[model samples]
Target chain A: MATGDIPQGGDTIAVIGGGLIGTSWSALFMAHGYDVVLQEPAKAAWPAVPERIATALRQIAELAPDLPAAGQLRLTTSLEDAVEKAVWVQENAPENVPLKRAIYAAVEAAAPAGAMIASSTSSLVWSELSAAMGDPARLITAHPFNPPHLMPLVELFGPDPDRLETAAAFYRGLGRTPVFLQREAVGHIANRLSSALWREAVSMVAEGIASVENIDAALVHGPGLRWSVVGAHMAYHLGGGSGGIGHYLSHLGPSQERRWQDLGNPALDRATQDKLISGVGAEARGRGIDELEAARDRALIAAQLALSGQRP
Target chain B: MATGDIPQGGDTIAVIGGGLIGTSWSALFMAHGYDVVLQEPAKAAWPAVPERIATALRQIAELAPDLPAAGQLRLTTSLEDAVEKAVWVQENAPENVPLKRAIYAAVEAAAPAGAMIASSTSSLVWSELSAAMGDPARLITAHPFNPPHLMPLVELFGPDPDRLETAAAFYRGLGRTPVFLQREAVGHIANRLSSALWREAVSMVAEGIASVENIDAALVHGPGLRWSVVGAHMAYHLGGGSGGIGHYLSHLGPSQERRWQDLGNPALDRATQDKLISGVGAEARGRGIDELEAARDRALIAAQLALSGQRP
Candidate 1:
């Protein structure tokens, strides 16, 4: 795991596709004192990146008071220019394999030999995304949660373990917790769990067992609070009382299977989709997306601060 | 809705088990200034109840100051004596149908007719638990998360909504969040969602996609934080950006379905169980169950206090 291996000749970090995720990655890099070159071909959208990043930097600053002055943020429309002087490229492109492959091929040509192109992909995996990369080992899938500047999870997976470790160490230096995948899987780890959980949550709503509002409330009030402190596995470990998860499995494993069998596999058909849309609307309580996002950011920061000592 | 309707002739709340749940519920009832008659036939456990309740009360008090001096706590070995002067009964017996049924029948025979007997059974649904009750409507399933006094969820469901409302109002007055199920479902709301999430989480471990520690860390730092603020459904809505969940469902729904299909349905075979047990052991990082529990409680309190205003 060597930061020394980073191409010193190309001293800047290139962030491709300056959308929300790219903007967030830009803020995160800047907050940690790395000069970021962000590329967005959408000329109208480029104007919002700086201010969005500034807001994110302030939010990061609130959680971390002693952050250094942000690195200089550079915007570009050309992918060639963005990766020209890149020691590392954090690509936040859309989930299109062909476009991503083209960007990677182009990046490999323009960027320094040692520069790592990390994708901010949530849905796609490494094999498909890196199939077209000239140097596949140099391309790593670094998937950050929404608002990358705030959320500290970067799911890293690539062919090179040493490179992944190096990336993980660098993220750790920035106060991020990076989890490595032994192998690639769809949605990575967290999102798979999220989808599985939401499937049942949506099922409860569609089945009329509970309302969407109540289900969400139940989560935030109950298991959500627990998860913020401990993960699902550890929660059950602790839940198994003094005997730990072994006791839980030996004693309560049967009941868990029964519940799993009973869990709904409701399709996201039109009626279910409509129910979900309206339910989310009710849960929003007339608050628009902006307001809800603000509240979520606020709560995330406060929770992270409070759990700093206890974070896994 | 009708606290006044509680049988005034019997001026105490009967807690018909002295296990962990009973102890927590006893502390909660006593913390709210209700005299509690705790009945645990095991004389060996009687002495520990007071100290356990005291510990739970202090935990509750830490989250909320200005709490009144705790009400009286009387431990009894006989269920008849415990409920003889009970206005309401909160039964926390083990999840054995015959045992719980017998307790409910005995409580009904001795206690006032208007008393609402609430069961804190997590696994058994209302129908199974209340099958033998003379007045089935009088039996409400009030399932609380572990360490009941601290975690604020109380899932309420019964035959009658009015009675459930009364229970909900009472729980609210006690600073607990009560979520009602329009209909009974196995595992209620939070636990069902919890089971769904854990199944995927365990699959990741069993499949060696990630270590137990990394999976747990991913959760605490990522979706867990988001869930603490919102919920699985609302997180997607927010993730959809300005278009909300409707946009998310329309645009990302296919990807979600793909991921869901890819989700592993691993059985908890002995080998998988062994992996989980050892995985949790590694994740515990030499912390004993007691130490882990203290950390969990500490984090839970901090998170709750931090998000008190944001709580649903």
Candidate 2:
């Protein structure tokens, strides 16, 4: 359970399922100097995983250029071979329950008992995923936000506290921000909060209150920028002036509650869905997915560096 | 009614209040090269307004360095004298209804007939504030997020379409992002969406689901970063792959609805308030309010530059 006991640069780690998430995780592990063994069941994906990993590593280099050289990348088609000698196993299979269960079973059976097992699943609860495993205590949920190599969040939750602590230490050593959940939840922490905000955002558009471009602009220029530095609670605490959250709650909490009650809950019916698609298309303004994604990644890097007090 | 007809730089603007918001507005107007006449009823704030405006102008200079030379800052105690011959007036008085009504009434009597009057009110709707005004057509609500000099959002709504258009043009001329609301709502667009997200964030903490530091980290590292680049609607559109938002709604909308139902609605009772204060204190980690505010401003400046394609 000690931080130093976890795998380091010289150690080997297994990355099961070499899709976007898996490849990004591979890049991160390799960048941290851990030899990565990548396994992908999809035959077509085998041809592109290396290129994706390379792109991810380039992004990592831009974000943190001082890291040690990346370790070797070992590609394998067999899960057992990938996990056999790895000190840590990171499963990034599709979100299908049965597929994840089978993968976990294979990993538990093939990998060493002391090998730390983690999942990149965003939606499923750990208890459900571990139902079929014999030693589920070793398995933990280490859900990273999309583009795992860049985003610092890695939400860790598990049945055993010791394993969770071990997983936390491992992620921390890799220079990632790992948050531990007290219990299992549907979307964990970040996605759940995202869903809450998105629900209201979509409702505003569906109700014809504002256009898609305006809503997005409001966020990027308004609360979204603040949220990047402080959480909602802390923002309110600061808004309370010298008294902090206590004064804010006493004076402004009622208004917040009133606003919450008045919040929209528009259903995503066919008409609403059409409006959203068209609105987003207008906002896209001829920018393709690749261009938008690149812009997002660049902005994220700049914001991250700025948050850490580094001049971008 | 046309954008060209609206006042531009070098035009005189009357700022009716000299608090935090009013000072920020004055800084922005001055930075944009508009002569600003600041009127503060509280004599105690008159001496500090100049210092606050200086700080805000410095921050604005960091965000936008190519602006014209700042206009003259005229200090006065009489609202009538401030608005007598000004082409535009920005009211940032307290949130009380009657005080705003009286201020508007006085502004209408003293200001020129064509002067565009705007309120920096965060909560009250325009119709309520203009109920007693003889010329409500010229009065509008132009709500800005905190630190108006740095944040680029300005929510504009009014009874007159032409007036709203004029206000939009004016804010755009000042290099600010202006969102027009189709109708009035409590907390406007940004605050409402912020409250929705904060409700779930507070619920998670009050329910013992996660700690304050962990929740804030999850947001700053996860969705908050994405939000600075794209709004929720566009993010979901991109998340849907090639088919866009329609596909995402049909496939994942149900799960979003489920999450919305599961979202919490926690009250700010005494115990909850205390927990929030303690949590924020721990997160602050001995950093005072001034330090946190400075950090937030720095991150915001970096984010704004990155979003605009400038290398910070």
Off by over 4 Å in 1: A1-11, B1-11
Q: Give Cα distance to truth, residue A186, candidate 1, Å.
A: 0.9
Residue range A122-179, candidate 2, lDDT tens digits: 9898999999989878789999998789888899999787677778889988879899
Q: Ten residues in a row with the worst lDDT in model 1 chain B? A: B1-10
What are the clash counts of all predictions, listed in order? 0, 0
Residue-wise C-alpha lDDT for candidate 1, range B146-214, written one tens digit per residue: 889999999999988778887887788789999989899878999999999999998998999998988
Q: For model 1, state the Cα shift of residue A261 in Å.
A: 1.3
Q: Give the TM-score of candidate 2.
A: 0.96
Strongest candidate by TM-score? 1
State the lDDT of candidate 2 residue by residue for B114-197, as single tens digits: 888999999999889999999777788999999888888999888788778888988988878899888887788899889989
Please give, as one word, the docking class of candidate 2.
Answer: medium
| Model 2, C-alpha of A125: deviation from truth (Å) | 1.3
Q: How many clashes (backbone atoms < 3 Å, residues ≥3 apart in a chain or on different chains) does model 1 have?
A: 0
